[model samples]
Target: MNGLLKKQFGLVLMLMLLAMLMYACAPDEAPVDEGGSSDEEESSSDEGSSEDSSNEGSSDGEISGELEIQYFVGGYGDSWWKEVISDFEEEYPDVSVTEHAGPNINEEMRSRWVSGDPPDVVYIDGAGSSETQMVEDDQLMNLTEWAEGIELEDGSSLVDSFIAEPSTYDGELYSLPLVFDAWGTWYDMNRFEENGYEVPKGFESFMSTMGEIQENEDIEPFVTTGQHPYYFSRGMLYPAFAAHGGNELLADIVQGAEGAWETEEAEEIMSNVEEMVDAGYVDSGLGALNHTQSQMNFLLGDNAFIPVGFWLPNEMEGDKPEDLQYGFIPSPMNPEDEPMAIVPDLRPLAIAEEAENPEAAKAFVEFVFTREYAELFSEHTGAIMNLEGVDLANNENVPEYLIQANEMINDPEQVEIFYKPHPMSADLETPISDSLVSLLLGNITAEEFIQEAEEAAAEYREGQE
Candidate 1:
């Protein structure tokens, strides 16, 4: 009887040890929900969830939803943007797209914001207008999160060269930089060769050539419109400002500091403008002219050089005289200062904060960033592709000087968005531009011009506060 009892005890001990080992290795299932269940069962159920968490689906795919996009395309003046949108619709069939043309895009957007009805995605001119204000107001989406998963064509950062930090606010990206537009001096090569003049090397050389052309060839060396201040700010004045001071002046001005325009560095710039007026480099008629008039003169070859953007090729298309060999160069710089290139203004598309289909808007931005769409845009507009790894087209329409300008951008040391950083306001560029025109027309002395500009700038700052 004692031996039988000892055997039973040993057998029970072995069974208990075996049960413990099984519990350690096995996954716990959901505890049978018994209101009377012990703590041990709940602990067992929690352990089972760890394995399931690791198996969650992580596949990436395009999503679909109702999306509304408001785009302004007056400058493009063609089917290019329309075609691209149609292509987007076909590619993402499930995404229902509603398109509204934002007439007077800036004013329309401002009105819509007041009415509390803004579009999901919209396009605004990058000529340093009201778009920057929207970014500051946090009206745009923070695209960094959405861009992380994207793999660009070259397997690099999704937002490549032209589309990066310029749209950033407080270290977070707000909008996408779409097509790149850089301002420079557009020229007619046929006329240049015909006149037997070497391309101007620097500011002095350019002015000398302009003088010679005016005196000998009887052509308007340069033509500009002073009626709109943007022409002066972007095309003539700002470029000269960057040339004189190493591009930091504008940023300093934006940050409540004086710009080089008020410093000794600006003497060369102001002197150049004064010299142009005295020597007849620019048309004497510019006092009443407008931006379109400047481009019109260049296209007619009545003016040899016009300050404009790469988009001039598209803008001048039908109006461009036959056999017009047009090209572009960096706006003439102060000979001593290091060369500075404009960070091409990006035609960014931003999703409104209240956008009903934020995901679809983001997806559209992603799709447009792809090489196919980027290349399509470049081809259509004769504009540079914003995507990485895509080569600048060597087509018949691309001007040689534009190619040279693009080379200047390759140097990381020289290219920057310094001048373009100012947020748009009715009070900012307009007042300064008018002051510049006043200086040109001898209505305001240079010192008076500087003081008035500073006063207007101070008012803008106060409004912001």
Candidate 2:
């Protein structure tokens, strides 16, 4: 009986030892809840879902949506747009872009804008598009905050990169200046050199130069369009006004202040035009010509100098003579001592107030304002972008005249740039343009032009009231 009891104890001890060895060899079990899922497994599942949510659009968390862009086709053309869009797609592969662009895009997109379902982005240029009107109609998004702190790829402030700041209303930015265009006088360098003519420095030099050109060259010394008299009024007269009376006079003229156009400065500018007309330095047949016709005449060597924008070369690219060498200068409307004044004509780019894809729109805006794109713009458009620090002089693709003009534009000592606080109303501009045509044709005196302009300003103000 003692031996059997000992055997039973030994068997029990062996069974207990086997159980301990099995427990040691088996895998560890996690703490499980009532649902049969372990805590560790639940945690891992939650982490995986979080990662997927973070990368919904792309692995790098890029925005993905339909981005509609509206741009106008003009002298700049649409090649740059196509290339940039392709590049943007490569950067954000998931985003889809739709272009609403053409020469008449402003008119074509009018209905969409009126119905409050405009495209994501809009380039305010060409006919039928006015940035001021858009602001009044509440069609643009306020980009002041986003623009203030935005940075370029090289760690420079985006706003600081602009050659000119965007126009603002009530201290809020609505549009960015995308194109850097300035009104100035254009001539053929080769023609001037052949005639031994010098570029004018100021009003006095301008008159003398015109006289010299008139006496020597068979071509008209100066030419401007009557159909678009703003070529003279805004291009030459406005800059002269600023140079004479500074920004204060410009503000008054823009506001249509009573007799603003009859100031001493205005009289002097009109008198200068009168002097040119009386001397026969002005083209007598301009009253019958439109902008393109006048420009064509200038390009054909019928005229020695013409007032126009930087787009002249690009606009007349196909028609320009092979021997023609473009030359540009700010209208020498200032006195001999004062620096030349530049009136920059900025084309604005805006975001719609009701964009379907705000993120993509903002992203595109940021993407477009880089130096790389600015150089591309110069390469494709043959004109400068609104960005600062673009090296156009060294670029073989850029025209030599544009390179020289850009240097003058950036030199503060050579030029003083200014803008009117507001755009002139159609009512005000129409009569001014008409009177200018009459004045240039030698039918109206300087005093008469001023009287007509002041009367028009009064009428515009009364209509506004």
Candidate 3:
């Protein structure tokens, strides 16, 4: 895989780690903290202008300036960003958007942020750049006032339209999550229909389906990016943990709570995957395949399932099998459990606090978060925007899989978690990944995998102290 099509295994790894950690400890229901805002006040669509930042320019609402923007250009391509920019600039004809985007954007923007020459706004989603670090260093502007004070075209407060809490410091939003997706398993819907196979609704049925596929046909039932097992963490292994203990057990282990990692739960979790492998459901050749290869294997009808994110269709746009009806279902880690979606805290676009053009940066934020742009984002990328009222069902161009995911995520009955519980440390990524690899490869049992990860977590926590 190369060019705009190549998969960034590392990005997948980071996101999965987050999926594993963040929500493990998340509250059952995290309402936007009202600090000083009241229920009657919040229920009103129009917020008083008190939150308008003192730094906001007196523009008479005519947004015009040079806005510098950068975004990641990977499988989730930059066409949507460019389209939004064009619309923004057309609306403000006097404005010019300078875009510096690509797969390497995070690295490219590094020196600029260091030299205090970063762009006015950056779409900080992909592999690099840390929104938390940037926030801690005071490099990004706080959107508290504007986000709360400004009314959208619909009269809704800008922040009120999102499912996200205005995760703020001193009522300030350091970053907002604009785009959201969960890693999941996809199958050939047509194949399932033809074979009389029901889409698995729970992990038990999912595993049984895998066994049935192998038992009833020569085709392999499952194939993942064997070279990148973390792909399994989201729709696969994490669901297993969620299955047995719900997020409570997961929270204990991931949050570094006392005596958390040292448990039989780890052993139990590994058994889920082990039983599948023992059932001969996993492809033997999986170890040699990369993400694209394995994905193609499923698309070509050589395999029945591939675990991937919502980006799979776009990434394989050119190579996808003709007339193939792709189908997706969240990993049914536990069949009897209620609906759940693996949401992660990948950061969104934010203005640099040191932005030379603060006004333009704010305008850019406003432009992209609108209903029109959110719809366009979903139509173009097949992923839902985290912003409120941006439903895939509203866009006919959106794929069925995305629409399904959008509905599942927003279903009030379902629980969503912003994943990525990488040990709250700087150095645990590799070692933890190594432990997962060991567990998957059978080089280490589940107990061993948990021990190694716990050891790494211990080292990370100590360093934090």
Each candidate's TM vs. the true structure?
Answer: 0.78, 0.81, 0.76
Model 2 residue pairs with clashes: none
Per-residue C-alpha lDDT of model 3 across residues 257-336, encoded as one tens digit per residue:
55555666656666767766666777777767777788888888888887787778887899987879878766666544
**Candidate 1 residue-wise lDDT at 150:** 65
lDDT of each: 0.65, 0.83, 0.69
Which ranges in model 3 have alpha carbons more than 4 Å from their true place? 1-65, 114-116, 129-139, 164-172, 226-229, 240-258, 263-267, 283-289, 335-341, 344-347, 412-426
lDDT for position 170 in model 2: 67
All models, RMSD in angstroms: 10.3, 9.3, 21.4
> Best candidate per lDDT, number?
2
TM-score of 1: 0.78
What would you estimate as the lDDT of candidate 2?
Answer: 0.83
Worst 10 residues of 2 by lDDT: 52-61
Per-residue error (Å), model 1, residue 385: 3.3
| Segments in model 1 whose C-alpha atoms lie over 4 Å from true places | 1-62, 126-129, 160-164, 254-256, 336-340, 394-426
Model 1 CA lDDT for position 338? 54
For residues 1-465, write the lDDT of model 1, one tens digit per residue. Answer: 999999999999999999999999999655555686557644543442345422111122334555677776544554666787788889876566777663355655567766656777776563333566776566777777876676666676675444434455556766777766777777777877887876775777888778778878797688767776565556655666666565476454444454434677665567667777667676767788766677787787788887776777776677878888877766775463455545355567777877756667777777777776666666677676555555554544455555666666665565443445534455566777778787777666666777777777787778667
